[model samples]
Target chain A: MKPEQKPDQQTLSSTFALRINGADLVILVLTIMLLFWVYNRLWFKQSSGKADYLVVQIDTQAPVQYPLNQKRLLELEGRKGKSIIEISQGKARFIHSACRNQFCVFHGWLSTPGDTTACLPNRISIAVKSHSVKDTEHFDALAGER
Target chain B: MQLHFTTRHDDHRIALLAALAISIHIIESAFPSPLPGIKPGLANVITLFCFIRYGWQTALQVSLLRVLISSLLLGSFLSPTFLLSLSGALLSLASLYIVQWPFRQHLKYQPTAIGYALIASISHICGQFLVAWYFFIPHPGLFKLLPVFITFAVLLGLLSGIITQLLINTDTAKI
Candidate 1:
């Protein structure tokens, strides 16, 4: 056989020999198994109860509470003039605000016990606070946890 | 007869492969994912095949072409989704190239498809995660999906590797 044909021979041999090796297969399997376990622990498992209230706080003033069962539109004052919050179907959202960035308005809704939306520029924030201390601490007080 | 693999042939082959990859990408995207940020990434099979048969440049061209053309077809070009896809492709390509460095140097070490695929998949997810955190969400809360994304990557990477290996073993493969 000519030397020019050696490259083709090598390629053929390489292709014929290609298979999933044991070590790599085992690693992949183990990694995937471990990751699935972690994912289930973090997200898939369920907890009970809904949020008790939507707590809206502006600046240093007292926090305002709205029961989750009630659906209403709140027009509140913020550092950047008027801000609008809407609560419906057990969810609260910062729908509109005068802040330039509109970060809070884009945050969508706070439905879960620990969900939160804050407008830093407007010095306004909303938190879904559960009445039970255990539930509250599990999500809300774990500020540095994430 | 002298077989001249000219630039025109290369260009035509690249275009054909890109079309194949783009079709696969779009079809996969149409399937509803079980979880957010999880994808089978079957298109990377074409990239791996190109890298092994042609070279890094061809592989890069195929990948970028797939991303660009597919995103345009999906109506997500220049959007955050497009940015995420671009970043993921770049990082995976970088990882594939890194794994092949030793072979390029005439070293005895050679990474198999499984190894390359695993590394590329993990890097792809990491790249997308970082981009999502830094630009789209800008919050640590995004980390909540890390484990899910990573698990999917490993599973999908291994799957793609097996598929590529099977294809390479076939007699009909152009390579």
Candidate 2:
């Protein structure tokens, strides 16, 4: 065998290795496993992420921002009367509302993104929110409500 | 006075391949990405071809030249985007060099384009993120994005690798 034939032998794989080799298979498997781990890690962080803040939106007024981790009480004047809210343990809740049925207060604690409670009659609402720019993704392919 | 530059056969090959890579780069840039810094990097197909057919030197020339010319055309020269591009190209080339170094003269296991692509793309994004976090955004929060970026790198890397393998395996690939 001439030395010139060696180059051709090398190019044989380049020219005719139509079937993927074992190395290619291994690399593909490893890459897919990596993607799986990364997806699990990132999606878990995303799904389990807690709210960092609370926003109180009064009727036709600028929403007031409050930290979730900070325990505090807020009494804001609404359309009809005062609505009181409380923040504690990284959760926010409507403590008292000047509504007929007290529905907002009974709605319980809000602790994640897209969680909210509103006193409809008083036109006041408090929402648990997180300041993550990565919330752009939807829950499912069908664009289910988050 | 007739002054001209002498060139090798490989030089013209580099020019042609670089032009091809640059065109692909420009067309790819027109795409809208779901997130910044994520791209198919289709131009790498040309670079990988040059690497497998010619050599690492040719691949390096084509990749670097593509980044430089494409950035200039895209009006991002000397900017952060250029920095990321240059860094990613350099780091991926270095990784390819190391990977090919072992199989230089061998009769044993041959690492295919898939392995090289996986290594190259992952290290490429790692280098880019290093530059981004260190020079541009020095925040611990940025590290949270590492897994996400790497995930995309793996996916895109596999895609480009399959394309490269097909190109290499084709009978007319010698051209």
Candidate 3:
């Protein structure tokens, strides 16, 4: 490779040639701050408290939401056939399904907020999300209005 | 007559740079990172510097040697972690080549060392993440980790780039 210019002689005078300038530093700082803010918001921000519910969706139908405090067995219609899901102790899973792989069954439990398990062949997806206290209070207010 | 394109001197230069990169790789691995997938990847500074000084081929040689030798030392050879490292190195090299292509041919806006570092680092993380997601985890939740990975990449990328720039500008960087 031909030497374009000797670093010792040419570079000293042109120190800023490849160096990060003030503008670049400012931009970098801003970008990092923005990213940290976003990451904190997405991953660290607690939604009132721990997740208190499980949402089960099958195919294109509306999702069925359940309070985690209650324990029950739910049967849902999947694309291929029916699936049996179990909810117990604020966690849920696919106990039985017609799908061949039974991947969802092996996926174990969904207990944490943002945890999800899905069996595509069966078209059933389950997610754990926080049900805020305000929504519960709103529901209670609606009942009182009646 | 066979034309000797790369001389004996070039081979020595390549070996020297590769050794420097390998040392840095092993040393960086010793430090524990707060996050599992987050690392400063200081060895990439050598790759970027070599690319600017010599060319892409030399840069590739140095990076691949570093990954291979370091993994062997770390006892992760042929393991899933080794595969991830290999993929990351290969993708970073490929991206470096693509990024420098225009600058090599056209007198377009000359990309700074930071540009090369940023592009290569991001591609490296992406390559590793894709392999991890597809082979190791295979979960949609893996996508959630992308933002953190990218943020770390950006931070480390800029840092390594500035260090490379300082080394180059100070005449301390040796090819």
Candidate 4:
């Protein structure tokens, strides 16, 4: 780097050096705002005053509703075998399953409305719901019917 | 008749960078993701490095070669995973190229490694999501995870950008 050289020309090092400048700080602020927005959206469901139950379905059977606030150890029968789900407080989780992988069991607890998990091999699935059955069509639309 | 092959200095540099990125990619794949389609993408530091210290063309070569070779090594070639990797790489590179256009005339104010990396990672994840939605799972339900993905992209992209900056500022980064 020659000190006496004219500053008119563009150099690679001068142009794209990753310094802590105003532009970087501005971007950082924008990213943080986006993160907060996403956090708020996800958090909205929990306190919507309607998130109270979970929907459990074995294979193509009609979905069954269970209150998330009620503590219960529920056993469900599927094609392969039986699975157990534990619901307590405002959260529910798969404690036991017939599948070898146990991905659903490892999925921990689901407490958010619209959250879902499935034991593909056992043909059992669970989804957290926030609305009444009459609004299930809207719910399914929101859930993408997955 | 004997065939002779020539390896230029640029070729050697590209190979070295691609190998570094591929190693990082392979190591990253070994980690279990809490959700599908989420990765730390530490390898992108190399891509960012190439883009800045070397040039756009060299960066492109390193990034693509890392994708191809890593897919082949991971045995996910031509699979959905590979497709996601390809789209992500292409989109990120394109974003960097486009983002770099205006500064071509000037030395200062060009978005540096931090800016470049943030855009690269964000576009990379979006490209992956688009591919996943279009080809594998068309469920809009998948989009429910968008916030989570974007959040990770932003956080990880910033971290990667910072790391790249630190890397370049080091004397040994001249390599």
| CA-lDDT, candidates in order | 0.80, 0.82, 0.79, 0.82
**Sort order, DockQ high to low:** 2, 1, 4, 3
True interface contacts reproduced, per candidate: 0.23, 0.36, 0.19, 0.16
User: Which ranges in model 1 have alpha carbons more than 4 Å from their true place?
Assistant: A1-18, A21-146, B1-7, B106-108, B172-175
Q: lDDT by residue for model 1 over A1-146, one digit each (tens)?
A: 75566778776776667555554565567666767776886577543546779988999998888898788999988887888999888788988998888999888877767778888888998998677724413232214333
lDDT tens digits, residue span B38-153, model 1: 98999988888787667799989999999999999999999888999999999989977876885696533555677677877888998998887666665434656888688788
**Chain A TM-scores, all candidates?**
0.66, 0.60, 0.56, 0.63
TM-score of 2: 0.64
Docking tier of model 2: it is: incorrect
**Model 2 segments more than 4 A misplaced:** A1-17, A45-70, A74-146, B139-148, B171-175
Chain B in candidate 3 has what TM-score?
Answer: 0.91
Candidate 3 structure lDDT: 0.79
lDDT per residue for candidate 2 within B1-175, as digits (tens), equals 9999999877888899999999999999999999888899889888887887788999999999999999999999998899999999999889878877877886255567777788789889989998887667654456568788998898898788888888877764335
Highest-scoring model, DockQ:
2
How far is A85's C-alpha from truth in model 3 (Å)?
9.8
| Leading candidate by lDDT | 4
Model 2 DockQ reads 0.18
